[model samples]
Target chain A: MEQPEVAVAAGDTSDPLTGLRAVSSLRVLVESYELRQVEAALRAGMSWQEIADALGVTRQAVHKKYARRIDPTIAVPRRNRT
Target chain B: MSRLTDAVVLSQQIVVTATEEAYRVGHAELELDDLLVALTAVGGPAGDVLRSLGVTVDRARSAVAQVHADRLARAGVPAPPAQPRTLPRTGGGLPWSPRADRVLTAGQWDLRLVDDRRILRDLVREPSGFVAEVLAVLGLDAEGVLTALDAWVPTATAPSGALFSPDPRPWRTVTRRGWVPAAPAEVWSLVTDPARRTAWDPWYSAVEERADGVLAATLVGEAEGAKPVPPGFERQEVVPVAREEGRLVEWELRRPDRPGGAPVQRLAVALTPSGGGTRVDLTVRWLGVGGWRAVVGLLLRPVARLAWGQMLLAKHAGIARALR
Candidate 1:
């Protein structure tokens, strides 16, 4: 049996769906590192309001877009699922 | 090798006991219909009680049941007992005495719940951030594990002897690495789903259902060249401890080869939100198989956890991506 195409190319990290491709796996790894820049900006232990001002978005939008997603399933009530 | 196996077996037992007590003690026993009847019948104590709590009697009762079932399934009881085997219900047995052949000694832990905000702090914004974080902690390659950790989230908490205590057993536990994810929800979706467990877990062979809402999972060692799989092992998950926007997943382990041809393990995952990401807490315990010494176990845990954490990191990444 042949292995399925695990990647389009061996050396680079590019996804057809995401449109933008990283030059290499290392680049892909570092791409997300920049998100830490946003993270650092948000919380210097700063308030979401303060963070929102820095990002130039309303606090609510920031909370919605940037806030963590909880396990909504966590709020699901357990019962006899008929 | 036998010592390593024993460590896995013993630590799992203690986790099971402490985890069950956490959920069972805090739950309310009333069913939904019972609450409805109380709601209509009173300006009485029950109705007043409901109002005081700021929940309609019906909503309160239903919510309680939901939490109860979530807690049970999250406990991981569904994974092991999906098939009929001799494993006991509570967990695997462990003895403190070396000659007696038990796992971790003593029960009752100092475990507590992780507040919501604290967990959120560990989150990542990337599609596979939970998986990525898991890889970071597992010390896996950044590329492979980041996908998994990017979606990581806490499933449960069992107050291990994480801190110093007079009793050596709880205090001296094996190290379970920090589990993170790009998105905590994605991790919970992958782990809590009975079908997806085998995709990431190294120990389980396949996952199946034994009865309504009950799950059974077969366990097999995937190590290279390890032939003659140990006696039959199973995984079971009971009601989940908590499954909301954040998940507290409860799960247990079953090993048939041990003394009773059965031993046990347990786990919990919890999530907290921070900034644009989440903080996750993961707990695993060894139920049966006795005579665990902290010093002896400590020397082994770092290496063992690193190995398993790598596997989990990979799984978390792949599954989280799939979830997306």
Candidate 2:
């Protein structure tokens, strides 16, 4: 069977359709990668604030998103804590 | 109720019990060992078979623990003393391991629902893995269990269409909803247009509309993290069942080569305008299958659901990124 021609070339953001599709795929990849990193950081005893800083997000935002998913006891105390 | 419906209800109970067992053990995912313990607890022909073979809930639980300890010892890690802890259940049930998912769906399709006996048979049939390890810890082997199961029979006849009736619903539906950061029109176009599919949809490498208004597509391989098309089912014929321009689109995914075969999947997408974005509701319905192939297909249902959910999430993110 002949290969069908793609409407737009790979990584070609000139077309709105292709551009939007690329964004979605990239987002999925980013989210999966982020999850792995967060899990590793938690296992390494990183604090929520530290992980939030690494991701350039607010501590509350990161904590709210992941605190429930991971074991609470595994996370270390915030760096500011005594 | 029909035997299939009875099996379905029992299977669900087994899954719930298995999830609780996994949670109690501090395991993040439901494994085959947990299912074995669950089967013993959920009384039925499978439980009866196991009980007759001296496999009780308590015995299975201890065997599972011993297997875990043995594995840890083999890895040169000291096994922690058993500690009982009560943890709050997570919102959704624990995710099932791929192997466990396969075992749960290993029943013969002719039997309809994956009955308990089939699950037990599959568990014992495992040559290695958690189930096998646990069985070995219990001083039992696959052949011994298989022999026992073959010889076992129900003491009472299963109640037939007397009081309860077979469930009318045949297909299992999985629905996922996401907010895409794009206008309803844009999201609709992305979903309905075959030309733009490969861009956002990871499942297809190429999709072209046929003259008959059906879709013929080349599926991407599993390397791309997309669900693999079953062997000899490489060719797909997607016929649109219903559509509302810029709102909803429904299609029946079938295999053109398998003439007269029931549609394998039904997909429906509804796009609703929600504050500055589009709310995308994707529904995937798996049609029933019979014979041995159904085992493979049914087993992959959980994996397929996860894959579809992830794909939708990615598509939503991409649309948002592009629009932003």
Candidate 3:
């Protein structure tokens, strides 16, 4: 087993801004991953309402955004109020 | 004019030992583990400090070896490529890399005297350095070492002589802690939200969130009937450089440009969750001081501390009230 490196690099904390940049980048990646998962669910025969419930969003809201991409022939639905 | 003369022979020995260990591992750089092993072998004030903190030479050696073994296993490197002793120790005198040089330099500056313990203190503070690797295996961090160092009082005589005692510099750190009757998340929200801050914000009059998580704020000086802003000082940018939601927030305040450069003051607020409330620790540090200001600060440390305490008290009171 390889021992994990836990030491701070020589000048890692010299600049405080570096950590902030890292967090920001990580957040962007997280958002991208969430989007990818949602798209995959939609492509896997999951209904907009089901995806919306899993995401804590309204069915109509999910349909309005992803409906055309999920099923172009289906008519757009009005957003549902929370 | 060699400041390294205090226990120069001991220092040389430690360096050689560290180099030998680094060579044994086939690592060209003399890292913190090597230093730890060397320090352990020397067995002095630094060694005592390490022992007090539950660290030993054997422990350090084992930790370093474990890390190397893990790395080799992961990388599929051949086991013990015929020993590092076969290779020439790169760089005479243990050959400190720039990072090691910086660590030693920092130790000298911080301790104001070069000694084993001082070096140990500096090396332990390097979280991403080799010491950090060892510390991780030991279930410790830089902060843990710092806490231990603080609690430790030197007993044995320092090799640097009587004049080598650590002296107080002009620098001062003021840490004020307050309790807010809310969860850490709730308190963090109030603290970060400018709208909610209006009720108790003693530091900034206006705080606008800038691009990339920066905050532009007009700093508020003394309260009503207080002394005016000192001459040559102006309201400057305050950047929230690091933040851990509901936990830690570190900000930097840029000073007005001067000859050398603008000084930057650091402020960090840590929120620790307590019983149905949050404990907030706010620490302010003055960075970049030299020339006349340092001399003045040194002279007025007591007065400055009192003023800082008052300001922090007021701020804490305001926070408590707002939370209520």
Runs in model 3 deviating more than 4 A are A1-82, B1-171, B221-227, B230-234, B256-262
lDDT of each: 0.36, 0.62, 0.56
Which residues of candidate 1, in runs, are more than 4 Å off? A1-82, B1-182, B220-228, B234-245, B256-263, B291-324
- Give the per-residue lDDT digits (tens) of candidate 1, residues B160-179: 22211122244213323232
Using DockQ as the yardstick, the better of models 1 and 3 is 1
DockQ of 3: 0.01
Model 2 interface Cα RMSD in Å = 17.2
Q: Give per-residue CA lDDT, model 2, range B1-324, as digits (tens).
A: 356655655666577667766655655567777788877765556776777778777788888777655553333334354453343312236677777888876654656434577788888776444576677887888778778777876564221111111225686766555444356888877878888766655456789998999889777655443457787577777788777777777888887777767546777777776534565666677666788868887888778766765555444433432332
Q: Which is the winner by TM-score between candidate 1 and candidate 2? A: 2
Against the true structure, candidate 3 reaches a TM-score of 0.35
Task: Give model 2's DockQ, 2 decimals.
Answer: 0.01
TM-score of each candidate structure, all chains considered together: 0.32, 0.41, 0.35
Q: What is the interface RMSD of each candidate, in Å?
A: 19.8, 17.2, 21.2
